[model samples]
Target: MHEISVAAALMRRVLAEKEARKLERISQIVLQIGPMSGIMPDALQFAYDSLREGTQLEGTELVIHSAELTTCCRHCLHLFDSRLMHTRCPRCGSEELQIMGGDEFFIQYLVTEKV
Candidate 1:
């Protein structure tokens, strides 16, 4: 699945960083996936399992920091949170909006052995 590939890519980067820092193993991985990132955590977890096999982070915990769609109203200059792709501003009910956040998926932090 797509999540599998994403997990694989993530693990690759983490492994590279771990080696550079002389870390022996990973205890946990914290990830942030925005609302619009379109990546499911369940699928990602499954993928992580496969990708982590035989790696230093084989049994590491995966923690996700969820993000929601945050938009700023163009007309009222109000900031609001949403779970929609496109919707009227909640504060002023305006259609004119500028997306301020969401659309992100990346590793935030890693906890690992010092060496």
Candidate 2:
């Protein structure tokens, strides 16, 4: 699964941050994952758990926050957010839409132990 690679990359960034900040221990990692990001949270968590074994992040908690899908109607220029997928704009019923958000995969923040 590609989640392994994703997890590996995330781990690399986390390690870099830890080293850069000279952190003693990382307690948690908060992630913002969009519904349309094509990332399975369970699979990503499993991959992260497997990859962190025997590493500095072994016990680090992985927290995932599901982001809402936001879209704008091309015809009406109306913006709306939803957890479900929509083919048309709710305001104008136009098929033409611009996706404003809900296709993201990024680290939001990290919780670390203090010295």
Candidate 3:
């Protein structure tokens, strides 16, 4: 699954940073996932749990937070949350909109124990 690959990449990144900083171990990983990022949180957690065996992040907790989808109204320049199937602007009722958020997938922070 793609989530396994994503988890592998994330682990690689965290391990590299841990080695560079001489960290002892990772305690937690905080992730920010956009609703439209196409990355499933449960799949990601499963993949990470499967891949972290015997690694520095073996028992690390994975915390995921979802970001809301946002859109900018082209006609009124108003930025607002855009729900699925409701793309119209709430302020101006315009259908013309440019997506501003909800396409992000990234590691926000890592809590680590000192070496």
Candidate 4:
């Protein structure tokens, strides 16, 4: 699955950071995932669990946080949550909309043991 590649990339970054800091082990990794990021948290965790074997992150915990979807109406200047999956403005019913968030996937922080 695509989550495997994503997990691999994430581990690469974490490993780089761990090396730079000379950390002995990672305890936790916090990730913020947007609703539209197209990543399943379960799959990500599974991928991480599989990939972390025998590595610095072997016993690391993967924590995921959800980011809300927001959109701005280009016609009415209204901003609102898009959890309803509506493509238009809820206030003015305008079809012109600009998505502001909910397509993000990034690592927020990590907890590690210093060497």
Candidate 5:
């Protein structure tokens, strides 16, 4: 699954920082996930839980900060919130639109220990 790769990539970064800080263990990992990120937090958490065992972050918690999905209308020059991929604009009921935010899946921050 792609979640495996995603976890691996994030772990690599966490591990490097842990090493630099002389951390004996990791505490938690915080992620900022937008609504339209298309990545399942539950699936990612499960994957991370399985893959993290026996590693420096074996007991570390994976916390996700959920983000909302929003879009902007190009025709009416209006902004609105959306949970769907592409729907008519809420302001002017126009189909023409553009994405302003969301669609993000990134690591925001991490908490670790310094041994």
Candidate 6:
């Protein structure tokens, strides 16, 4: 699955960070995922857990934060949560919308121990 590749990339970044900073251990990785990011948290977690074995990242915690899908209605200038794409605005009944959030996937922060 693509999650495996994603996890691998994440691990590579973490390892690089550890090496660069001379960290003794990494305690946690905080990831922010949007509803439309097309990445499953469970699969990513499983892939990360599997790939971290026998590595410096072993026993590291993966914390996932899910972002809500939000949009702004052009007609009414009202901002609201949009659970689905192409959703009509509740206040103005307009299909014209500007996506404000929920299409992001990134590492928010990492907790590490210094040697």
Best by TM-score: 6
Clashing pairs in 5: none
TM-score per candidate, in order?
0.82, 0.83, 0.80, 0.81, 0.83, 0.86
Candidate 1 residue 22 Cα shift, in angstroms, is: 0.9
Q: Which candidate do you rate higher for lDDT, 1 or 6?
A: 6
Candidate 2 CA-lDDT value: 0.92
Q: Give per-residue CA lDDT, model 6, range 1-114, as digits (tens).
A: 699999999999988988898888889999999988999888999999999899878879899998888899999999887557767888888999889878789999999866
How accurate locally, in lDDT, is each candidate? Answer: 0.84, 0.92, 0.87, 0.88, 0.83, 0.88
- Which portions of model 3 miss their true places by more than 4 Å? 83-85
lDDT of 5 by residue, 1-115 (tens): 5988888888898888787877776788999888777788888998899999988788899998888777888898887776677678877989988877687888888876666
For model 2, give the 10-residue run with minimal summed lDDT. 82-91
Name the runs in model 5 displaced over 4 angstroms. 36-38, 113-115
Q: What tens digits encode model 2's per-residue C-alpha lDDT throughout 1-115?
A: 6899999999999999999999999999999999899898899999999999999999899999988888888999999998777899988899998888788899999999886
Q: What lDDT is obtained when candidate 6 is compared to the true structure? A: 0.88
List candidate 4 stretches off by more than 4 Å. Answer: none
Error of 6 at 38 (Å): 2.7
Please provide, for model 4 over 1-115, each residue's C-alpha lDDT reduced to its tens digit, 9 standing for 90 to 100.
6999999999999999988988887899999999889998889999999999998788899999988888899998998886557777879999998888788899999987766
Candidate 5 yields a Cα-based lDDT of 0.83
Q: Which of candidates 3 and 6 is the stronger one according to TM-score?
A: 6
State which candidate, 3 or 5, has the greater TM-score.
Answer: 5
- lDDT for 64 (candidate 3): 91
Top candidate (lDDT) = 2
Looking at model 3, residue 35 earns an lDDT score of 78
